[model samples]
Target: MKQYTLLLAEDEPFLGKVVKESLEKKGYAVMLAPDGKQAWQLYTSFEFDMCILDVMMPYKDGFTLAAQIRQANPKIPLMFLTAKADIRDVTQGYASGGNDYLKKPFSLDELFLRVAELLKRASPENQPADEFTIGSYSFSPKRQELKDSDGTIVKLSHKESQLLVLLLQNKNLVMDRKATLLKLWGDDNFFNTRNMDVYITRLRKKLHKDPAIEIVNIRGFGYKLIC
Candidate 1:
């Protein structure tokens, strides 16, 4: 089995140690960073395949660190592990470029599942396009971003990036909601359906800077990306 590098940032020593040891047992080489500043420093100094960050930390916060890390490498999978469950915080996590959000008091098995899902979905070999263009933004599937003319790069979560690729692949045509749900999430349940709605709204907002781009809903069936 290949060893995957993971950056684990947590201010709580006990919890961090537990999580780090648990992951290490699963064959991951985890670099534990006690604070967000140190996490950022470690991130810059070493290469990591995934990042697991705590929301609150000294010197820097998880959301801020996530943004900085996103700027450096958008495609690297990131997850926020925190006690904050406010809707605003969850929204911020996604906007700051996180692939998954797990609240504290979470089960280790659940964390493992989320991590595996994110990594499988974000694997480079499974990605659609390494790089492409959409309206005024240059889309890089590998980086999971939309770089604008002004050099503004909007980083996307794994699902958001995958959604964009599907939309771009079938621009001006209706893409099935159920098919999308199954492909990306492996299910079309009510909860996942509503979650997809939120993601669509976020993606629209992210691309709103470019007036020509739009992700238009297609009645009750699907969506069409109009450019």
Candidate 2:
């Protein structure tokens, strides 16, 4: 089996060791960071398929680290492992760019399942818009450009392009809140959730010129891209 690279950021030594061992046992190549600072450094210096972050830590918090990561690479998968249970925290996590949030004291089995599911969903081969056609909007992943029916071009920021690509890829399917956050932000935290909301709203406005395109919120779930 191919070894998937994972960046694990946890301040608790014992828990980090356990999680690292578990992931390694499952054939993942794990890099452990004991704090947000180290995690950020490692992420920037190396390549990883996904990030698992613990919210509270020394130096910087997980939310800040996740935002930095999203600014650098919006498509990398990110998940939060924290003890916080407040609705605000959950919303923050999603807004920050986290694709998934796993509460602390979670079962190892569930963690493994979540990891597997994220990897499966984010695999490059499964991305939508190998090419996408949205009314007058046309997007080609290979070219990373959006053009109107008249061939007028609309530039997309890196994150915007990635988010649009995901929406197009998962067209009509309910893109779960956690999944989207993890895939983009690297953690699910309050601030990031708000950021995601902003991005969603921006995307809606941009696509509004095309009546055939709509990004529908699935209430407490996620968003659905319809074209």
Candidate 3:
């Protein structure tokens, strides 16, 4: 039997533990993240067959995290668990790339059934592309590696890779500075802002071999990747 790994991001401790244990007992390997920040960290660091996110997590909500995840890997199965009964919230979940939304106060059995259904519908052939092309470079954000046409490979740190992906997603368009800071650092304070600037500089130097690939700052706005 193949063991499918699942990333479950739920801030509720008791429910998270119960769900994780239930999934593990059914022969799945589950990585439980207590908040959206740690969830994103786990996501970029590891690969998973599916994601189960709770809507109102701290640092980042499920919708924002889902958008980021969808930007990175479009085909992965995303399921949202939320207590909010509003129809708008359900619509927002789908808009954020969620494949299924389960209302809270539901049974564990139903949760298991939904998870199985989503996984069954996912196709390997339709999975996200393993590598992305950026000018003369071949990059795999999952592997944290950037390879130039000359075959020189530059390794990237977690923050560097995340920032690079964000820039690539908004290629040729301005990526909001404050939004990037909040998404990556959980805050847009002076210190994290400085840190982000440093990472941007490092990325620029790493991709300097190709003059066409430029990560430009948009003054008071954000950064843009021009390739």
Candidate 4:
């Protein structure tokens, strides 16, 4: 079985064809779907290492499709490829179980980088120490879930999982914002920065159950996960 199979659902024919070719050239076997309904059908028929979906489609939207995908397989990495840049759009995408977001008109290189990063993190060979204990919360990276002191399990999206892992890796030190953005989003642009802010807020809200875990803001620097 191929290790990096992908399912890409984009409504735009030109973009879809171009992206499909690009991914295939980069050695990812891709299954391209023109709409969310067919995308869901393909998803049900085959297993993909990751999914790239457009936020808008003919039959079903990306958010709805992602929700269905999440119900089926919570750990499969998913990315939203669309033109929507509004804060609410980003929030909805993450809430809908997206692991990453790439604004439309994106370069193929950037797309490749994002997909590769998500796959790398999801790949078993790249996973190290599946579970980590932090401040009364036990985190399972492979499962993208956190269990709190009260026994409530909080499911984390891909970006959230990666962000938390990076924070845990850095512990009490300040995580560099620019470096982190570059690694994950391929750029530290204004829009991406805003998206990061939203994700940070979500993470804080989720971790609020445990007072010991604080994602401290270091003015001008980045954030520090005080564990």
Please provide TM-scores, in order, for all candidate models, with all chains considered together.
0.64, 0.62, 0.55, 0.70
* Cα lDDT listed for each candidate: 0.87, 0.85, 0.88, 0.88
Model 2, range 1-227, lDDT digits (tens) per residue?
77899999999999999999999999999999999999999998999999999999899899888888988988888899999978688768777888888888999998998899888878977766466787788887667677887778777666777788777768899988876776676456677678888888988877777887889999999999988
Give me candidate 2's TM-score against the actual structure. 0.62
Residue 97 in candidate 1, Cα distance off native in Å: 1.0
- After superposition, which runs of candidate 4 have C-alpha atoms over 4 Å from their true positions? 1-3, 125-164, 171-174, 179-227
Between candidates 1 and 2, the lDDT winner: 1
Off by over 4 Å in 1: 129-227
Residues 184-203, model 1: lDDT tens digits: 65346687789889999999
The candidate that wins on lDDT is 4
Cα error of candidate 4 at position 102, Å: 0.4
Q: Candidate 3: minimum summed lDDT over ten consecutive residues — where?
A: 120-129
The C-alpha local distance difference test score for the whole of candidate 3 amounts to: 0.88
Which of the numbered candidates is closest to the native, going by highest TM-score?
Answer: 4
Ten contiguous residues with the weakest lDDT in model 1: 182-191
